[model samples]
Target: MKQRLNIASDTRINALLCSSAAVLLAACGAAGAASAQTTAHVYTMTGAASKDFALTGYDTNPLAGAGSLNGAIASAAAGAAGAQPRLLASVATANPSSSAVTTATTEVTQLYQSLLGRAPDAAGLAYWSQAVASGVPLSAVEAAIRSSAEYISLHNTAGSTVTVPATPYNYYVSPTGSDTAAGTKAAPFKTLARAAKAATRAGTTVWVAPGTYAGGIKTTYSGTSSARIYWVSTTKWGAKVVPPASSTNNNAWDNRGNYVSIIGFDVDGTNSGSGTKWTHGIYTGGSYGMIADNHIHNVAKSVACTSAGGSAIGVDSYYHGVMTDVIGNVVNDIGPAGCTYVQGIYFSTSGTIKNNLVYRVGAVAIHLWHDATNVIITNNTAAASNFGMVIGGGDFYHTSAGANNIFVANNIVYDNKYGISEQGVTGKQNVYKNNLIYKNTTYNTSLRNGLVATATVGSDPLFKGYSRTAAAPDFHLTTSSPAIGRGTATNAYPTDLDGKARNATTGYDIGAYQH
Candidate 1:
């Protein structure tokens, strides 16, 4: 005969009599398989052998036919003094690694369908499945759904107003995992594709574990202005995306979603000797997004110069007036030498490009070409490129008129083929001021055609250790560096490249570093 294990009163009696914990557990150990029972919605585990869980509250689970799980009877006691208090039963399994995959998948799917009235996304399904597999009580899962924004929006009455907060989900990606695995920290997705497929929601964070992943991953999911999607490397630069030896994938990271944030990953193009060449190390074709604290390097072709190569970090705004900011990135070795079209950091649309270090690029260290306008280029250090920066518009505008209101301020443009130059139909209103333009092969500040840098200082920004060829060059300023205290408050950034806030009382410094 089928029986339900109800331990409302006996569990408390058991908790009080800790001496009989083992005896009570062996007899009621099958309580671990409990599928349903409105606990005063309470349970407890006393770190002993057996447990008798309490039953309370109304029958919150409308769906019937709960599955049986198979382990610890000690995990079934009810009361919130400690660990045993909150656990419901599990999916259909007793342990996480057992072959209850069917039961786990089914139960999680059932919850998604019943509670949200829709199929669970890959990420959600994976999370719930892993939760159930790890012996998360079904009632807790159900309660989580009940508290979700989707459920509240679906079940709200006309007269009643409910404000259920959206669940912030986190999906994991690792090289050891498979695409089919539940995208949990315990069972992470193997590839960016799988993680992307699972993490298709606003406020979702895709945590990339330490491992080398294939390049050319495209992010197409969008998040709202209030809730942005995040793709983060768990360890800073530990998660590397190397260019595929041979594939049609051009960009290492191609983001086409609005309000997406890509943070703390290393995109290395050094392995792109074969197959489809890597164009952009990190490219964003979305608006209201951010590409921050990333290292992009070696975005160059094996062959001689060509116009087909792209920037190390390219930002394009799909929607006008919505900006995609590029901040705190260290970009270098971006292109083959003497390639005029290549760039370390390039933006064709509007964005706040600040607090970046660009060195050893092919063309312009930081180039603002094409339709870029209303752009803020500040708090940057550029060196060892064809041009420290070339801010101009191309034929994309198809007029004698160039991009307008381009603000360039508080930058250190030094030791390049040419220093900060402007070659466009710029208006007089563009704020070009407070820059250290020094020691270029050609001109220092070529601001003709209605573009000029006011208070442009041609001083050597003394560095801690200035080596133009070092792989890890120190761009920190000495105390007596002329760039210090020379920056204007107009268009000055709030933080330095190292994320340290500038001195509130003291004036802001120039270059990527504050002092």
Candidate 2:
């Protein structure tokens, strides 16, 4: 005769508790293939074991319908609940490892698709195929998945070698060490000599911490195309709020004729630390490559040799192979050296200085002297300086000498005696287009050397801040700013400093800065 089934709430809860525990144990490969009688004991001990249901093993298979797993759980649950013997007898058996290969391949494919946005390469595909053919287990399969090219490709941005700060160098305090040892952050090497020695080798990196590294720091090393020395800020904006290290003497920091970068250092040459002896923040001779993104100022007292013709940041004579790029820097309050002469940036070569903000120097803001050829000075803002710009070949306006193809385009010159003076010898082709020359009580009779060039007269070049960040100078023209669309359309000037394309129909604006 067939019997009718009856179940109670207490019995059902007991069964669930027991079943969960058995599943956990079986998943751990524990009690391998328990006999019928042993399975009965697991069911009897369900209520006690179920208290530790939170535990999981690496081999635990959480998926439903897995081999032998469903029956093992059911048997344990029934025995714990003290259910009928016939119910435990009905439990099924399974073997899930038979399909492990298929599962691993699917997982590898998914990982590749997510990381590379494509399928694995031929080599990767072959490695997996061989491993599976050799009957590798699921754990081996996981390891293989991690070793694929996809894993390594994700970290490509850091390049080959990992970069860390030089030894004995502190992000907060001063650093002292040579560059040969590991350039670790805690124990950073203080001198550039140390960094250069290590950076010369390929796959090596020298990371500089943030501080006003004092002068005479120089380096001479040729980095490979793949590996280059990186001198960067340890902090965001690199403690920009703290001013450069003040000096009672001269030449706070002088790069002694090395063809490497002296960058991201806030060098202060203020008040002549030792007396009126040195006055150059960075005086470069025999230096080449690039000088970018530095905040240099207050070094005039040490540069007392300007009677020999020196500048605040002077580029010395015989500068061949000095193909340097000076961009995105802030130079302020310079040129208090012994001599009455001071220039924010003085160039004597075929170089480019763009997107720089310079103000309040003792003398001319920018001076270009002998043999300076093919120079392009654009998109720079100068205010409250003695003179805006002074260029001389053998002579200035005669442009017939060494300084030819000189283009002074897109500049904002304001509040000075003269806007720009190009006066010297002859035969030089110069273009002074799209400039906003404005608002100086000291009036000049001749502008652009009285040459027939394009400029805005009676226009006020409105600045966001006359003494602060001019990279994005908000020259939003007030009703009185006369410099609106007075620019030439062919010049292709940027309408916004944020690098948005300008509206050609509106015509170009008059200065390096546009509304």
Candidate 3:
């Protein structure tokens, strides 16, 4: 337990009150020995549990102004002859506060001296007049200073609204010459490079309408703090967006440190089964980015960086400010056939990996790495992968702990090598609760190495019409399923797969789905 010093009892210094002058002297020294007041007994302050007397009853003394400077203000005002109150008020106004008030007063006085060529006496009437108009309140003067244009110019920021481009580049690349020369919907650019070149703002959204354009595209543009860069699909129909198989050229979607977002598109990696690849799809090393409502499937492999495989959605190498919203996306059958390590959707540090359906992932479905603290992994279903989900040491450099405060709840995980596994288990505080796990018999082969409730491990999750190849899987609970009304009483799930409300009065089922 911690210790502290507390007050015990009051040590009163009793003295005979002979006159009003003596009364004044006693009052000033009532708390402690001083010039005008009598010495009131004060006790030694000791240990935490002890109590000490707080001194009281010294207001009647007129000469008790010696202890503090504020008492002197009242004494000066009372003894003043005619205009002495005005003088006291001026002195009060001129003296600055302890922290910033002193500096402001000195600066204002120097400004007066700089103009009048002498210290302020009666000639400083303009300064006193300004203070009087300001209503003698310190707050008003502070507000006036803060509200100035000079202060705004020095301290204000443009932020996300002003710095980024207002309108995204709506360039459609088709067979009949791109939207370049004509610059209209009919006269579009031949390739994606022309559209990327015209991108000025950070989140300059470039909507690429469906139609196969030959060759590869490369862009080296960085967005600002307020703006970002985006490349998305414009067609209402389901189309595949892929790079040329024969070419070695690549496309770069670099966000630098700006907020970026990309929406709605699919890349065909197969290229009729020979296994072509692209550089990257919706890549970001910046912050405050979102990649949602898109279908990014295939791309030609990159020779420059062979290790960086084809990723459906990627958040490679970013830090604290990287707040991504990867939702409502459909990423299926990702990674090459023989690749050892592949990921369907990936993130680290403050990401919302929710409301997404991922299946047939070659390697790890949802991979989170590197000190990825406070990541909300909820309402996402994963199936048919070597591993359902894997979390590694996100903070490689920080010696204190790898990852802390990871909230993994209400996700439907099944049929993988491990339900969830952690390699660097040194100092990790992970919260795993209220999830539906089944079908593979054993939750994890290595029980001692993993950290999850043994009671939560069981058979098939019994999803409603849960198919492998359907456009969307139905995860609603059947009437006879054990998962119904089997959730924790305190942490009950609210909704099902189709966005319907669960049991409100009696509490609902477990996992992300409601019903």
Candidate 4:
């Protein structure tokens, strides 16, 4: 007998054939002698699974009550175990449950919204749906989406705003002003401490005019994530903050607030004599703050209390926050001789140190210690220091494990006692790459206790002109310098110290210059 069958267009099925009479002959042709001796019939579907269909056996034509080819294939698969060529039909006819579709749809929508900053298009929705249906986990899909360049760009600009208010909320400070005066530009306040005390709300900007200000500044005012409070100098290096002559342990400026900014001032830590106590130029105990485009220098601690060291810019996470930004500053003459613990830029937790010029410091130019993690140091110039950079371990009252996820790249370290040193557990979780190290006294790069640099270049950086003894030094790179095109391209900063493009061409130039 000859028989014919038709299956649905999009449905798939699988079946095992046990008899030659049940063979799936094309065009209902008579079975050959070899086929008649066959013990099994095999049928496979295109995309759908046989297990997805529930089928029943039928003694007569398997396609009799089969609503579609899918049903016919299901019926054939259902009777594959029987001796007789029995047919089977699909039992349930509905698609996947509404709950499953709804869940998939919700996930797709959220992934698009969070990762891409837009709604999903039809093609994208279909692609992700098929991917999920094919056993791809939603979390994996979300991770891939978040790792895209689009998501990175969006994340970098997440809390920034564009619209400027017509009249900014500003308070003014001046040397010849009174504390009782209104903080307006016409009648400014006398002290930064008074201005800070009055500017309590987010988006408040305290503008300090030209002149030297005495006394330490400490504030506890916090700002919102989107609108940060700013303490700015009207003229760079013109507004100076100096510690009181009698104060021993006072910092020039101490901020303990979150989401604050200190910009474009000069902090002078006057190291009068050998017995002077420790004092920092700018000490920050808050998070989500910025210390940028400032000049901090002359910080020191007395040898009598050598353990009480200070730093030019110190960031500590005593207020339970992270993400401080220290960029584009110049720190010089920090840690006079015989002071073993002074630092140029000292950070205790998560932060970024980039595009700064730090020179002539007594101790480490940049220090990352005390449970610091996800800290990045890049594109800075550190010369004439005891150590260029130190990723600290459990030394000097820091009992925690060393820093984790520390990245040091594209820096110029020269004329220092040690180029880069890793002490204690700090060396274990660090990545050092693309740095230009030369002319150090002892070692170019030291990873003590079984640590190693991920990548390093120990050679003369070939700068335009640099001298450890010169009255004024130049750090720009020459055209033929090896560091001209040797840096690893990074998204940490867009511009170098001299305001040049960080990646003007194919590759980034090492150190603080983009030549």
Candidate 5:
């Protein structure tokens, strides 16, 4: 038995009526009908549910000149004589019952990949797919995924933890060792360069014993996300690295590895030659790296006719790397004669710079310049520098790619030429909150471009025993200090500079120490 569907005029008119009813149902109805109506409406409007379906047959069809189903639907609904159901049927066939399930699965997979950095598991895949099938829009699902805590923690680059393996592969370097020996505790390599070359794999650690090594150490090894490479000193400030006289652009250690950590070493650049050539104590690039618990000093370049010198600990990205963690380091005396452009911690991109002590620097202690964003500067103590902290591009160099979204909080700034200075284009939208700024020669806080302090105190933050002329200054706050229990409670560090809890019950104290 052969039954032909004569869908010339009457059938098309019936389909048009059905599509209009589906559109109305989609606007207001139960979940099941709404879901069906959504599909019908999309097919009726686009003549296909997906781009691949549209390109396959709709583009070549002679009746697809306008590329819209609106005219055909309207004509069919208006009882036009030449209307055809074959075109509408083609769109319906293109989006079969299986196609809806495939679309839902694809959407869920894409959302999981985008928001969680992984594919959805079976349970999650089924749940999101069912939600999409039950009349939840994909946009709403995406918004919910983005607002989740997991997504926030993953995307918060300044606060995310560095991935390190439980059992690390170990190598050793010593002053009185041979390069030909195995880099073990008993038979260690003589030079840092040799140890760095040997420590190539992820989770590999190069441990340097107490020694002064000469010549620049440049590492080009990379580590995986789950197992970061580490170069650590046997004792903090015990292993020292000094740049050689033959070094052209003097740098004690130049690291260009992703997920690599440089920890607990003394990097001295006292012998760097004078020139316009860049000089640094420890220069870093790549991304997701850490510079912690180190002592860096006396690295500076001679002032040029136009530009200034480099930094002591420079977190730069000449090749588009992003995000570093610079924490718990001591940087001091880092500038050449009359050089006003040097810095203790200089960053050009996103980073977390916290719990560091900077003193007697030629320029700003912490400088965020050129395209730096999403930086958190907290719990740091800076003194006897030209400026305590400077946020914004340098006006002299006219560094156009300035800073934005900089969070300057819970820091101690005192006895500098200027406490804090904000200048240039990126100075806008910076948050200066809960800082103890006092006793600078010029001003406590300087603001530009409608920048406002969240809750800043410009008075002396009565320390235990602090003096501008003291050999070693103590910055612990007294009980009667106004900074006690005066800071904004939210977003303060759990532990202060001395690893003490920030607050008992009342509130957080300002500056590097808790009262």
Candidate 6:
């Protein structure tokens, strides 16, 4: 028996109907120069005590002919079985959505919202987007969404009291304590490494005391989606991580733990010897990891201009399809004055990079290279860099190629040499819109080489104060700001960089600061 793919031409997704022409739907705002108009809602990761929908389904198996679907859109080749429908690309009949999303990302998001009643996380978006791009039928995708534990849990009316997850155990790390001691508040561990060793359980949080700590800390802990191992500084940006007196090539904090989080630490590397070079301030390669509320600065600043090449925050897309949340971090002063090699935040693959303030970095403030795909970059303020940001892959970087459902929205990319550039020839359906990309020396947007942005809010983001030196930069939106109430909630972060919620009175405001 052969499979028939029936993609209904009508927008109402009643049944899978057939069509002849190849309809290419963008995973992330793929088509139409439509204005962004997604309704703002608080993001939730509803599910069982075992897992959450936001981070689950990231590791879903790709459709069999996913590779074949790449480069050239092809119809889904069904198994030599019954009259089941073929899964031919994102052949979706548009669902009724408050959001005007018309791409693969939209389809997945609509399913998540309508079926599961929550926003699609980076991992879920990436996995399902790929599934859709690989020609998984919308009906089957809808079935999968309906069968998810999260969806089931949401719809469960069993009349039983749901058990809430308990808070995880806490470990302490301080310079005044000894590693030999138990990792308690009173008897805190001396080194972060010792705390890391002790915090092997799921959701075990390690709180570091205020003091300078030696760099090159590595975390190999593992945790579940419901119980991530959290490493937090007792004071925001107080527990500083500085490279050892004579370090080179190594990083400040190499976090490689699955479902781990590093929060509120100051990773400063400006003190490394002039001849020495540190790779990155905070590098997390693990899946479902969170690097937030931290200040990463001067990663390779002390190194010579010609030798400087590193990032303040580097989230390595090691596992290909995992989600890492890089949020609410301030990355600044990285690299020698004009080093093209250095960047503020560099990552690849699927994840959420939001509510971040990247200021005065050397080159591209934020970059996605090497296996780049399915990312949401929103609510970030990037300023005073050679390039505000660059999202592209393929031969330009070597060993990297992609651009699928890469969503960018509600950002303030300002005062850079060039604003929001793109590369790679194989890229497609990457959205760049509703951003305040203003006052750059050169082009505000240069995605012509890859894919062009649909629309850009070219108005000057009237911040409370603007400084190129990063000395006293204040990116708060004033009353008469052009960025006020202009942002779309599509892939938008609810919180600003200061850990404050967006203005409740007005709609979504662009940039890192809402109020």
List model 6 lDDT by residue over 82-174, tens digit each. Answer: 222222233222233333323666787777655543566664465345445444445555644544444443332122111112223667789
Local accuracy of candidate 5 as per-residue lDDT tens digits, 1-515 = 11111111112112222223213212222222222322222122222212111111112232333534434454433433343333332222122255665788898787776455456656446544644664445653454444344444333222112222222466778999999999876788999889888989887777677788874778888887787888877666788887654665557788999988887788877665443244677888889889987889877644352354678899886656688988778887778533577788998878888778787788889988776777888878888888999887643232355787788887889889998888665756678898888889888788778777767777777889886656557778888787887776555656665556667587877776777
Residue clash pairs of candidate 6: 6-16, 6-17, 7-17, 8-17, 26-30, 26-104, 27-105, 28-405, 89-135, 394-400
Q: Is candidate 1 or candidate 6 better by TM-score?
A: 1
lDDT of 3: 0.47
Prediction 5 global C-alpha lDDT:
0.65
Residue range 176-238, candidate 2, lDDT tens digits: 554444554445666554554545543333444545444544444543334333444443224
lDDT of 6 at 280: 80
lDDT per model vs. reference: 0.69, 0.46, 0.47, 0.65, 0.65, 0.65
lDDT of 4 by residue, 353-461 (tens): 9888898888888988666778899989899888998886454343365677788888888889988887766645677888888888898888755656655667787
TM-score for each model: 0.67, 0.55, 0.54, 0.64, 0.62, 0.65
Off by over 4 Å in 2: 1-181, 185-187, 201-206, 223-230, 234-259, 275-277, 286-288, 301-306, 337-340, 395-400, 440-450, 455-457, 465-515
Between candidates 2 and 4, which one is better according to TM-score? 4
The CA-based lDDT of model 2 is what?
Answer: 0.46
- Among the numbered candidates, top lDDT falls to 1
Per-residue accuracy of model 3 over 1-515 as CA lDDT, tens digit each: 11111111112222322122212222323122211122112112122223221112212232234442224333323433331111111212222234443444555445333322224333223332233232233332222223333222222221111111223233445555654464334565666657756655554555455676443454446565555565555542133455555645343243444465655545555453223345445555556676655555543232233455545566654434456767546666766543535567766555667655666666567777655555667656677656677766544433335545566655667766566665553234666666666653345423223465433535577778777666566656666555665554333223343444556565556554555
lDDT of 1 at 113: 58
Error of 3 at 514 (Å): 6.0
Poorly placed runs, candidate 5 (over 4 Å): 1-165, 245-249, 271-278, 301-308, 394-401, 464-471, 478-481, 489-493, 504-506
Candidate 5 pairs with clashing backbones:
371-401
If the candidates were sorted by their TM-score against the true structure, best first, what order would they fall in? 1, 6, 4, 5, 2, 3
Report residue 374 deviation for candidate 4 (angstroms).
1.3
Q: How close is candidate 6 to the true structure, as a TM-score?
A: 0.65
lDDT of 1 by residue, 163-263 (tens): 11233566778999889998876788999877877878897777787789988888889988888887877666778989766767778988888888887
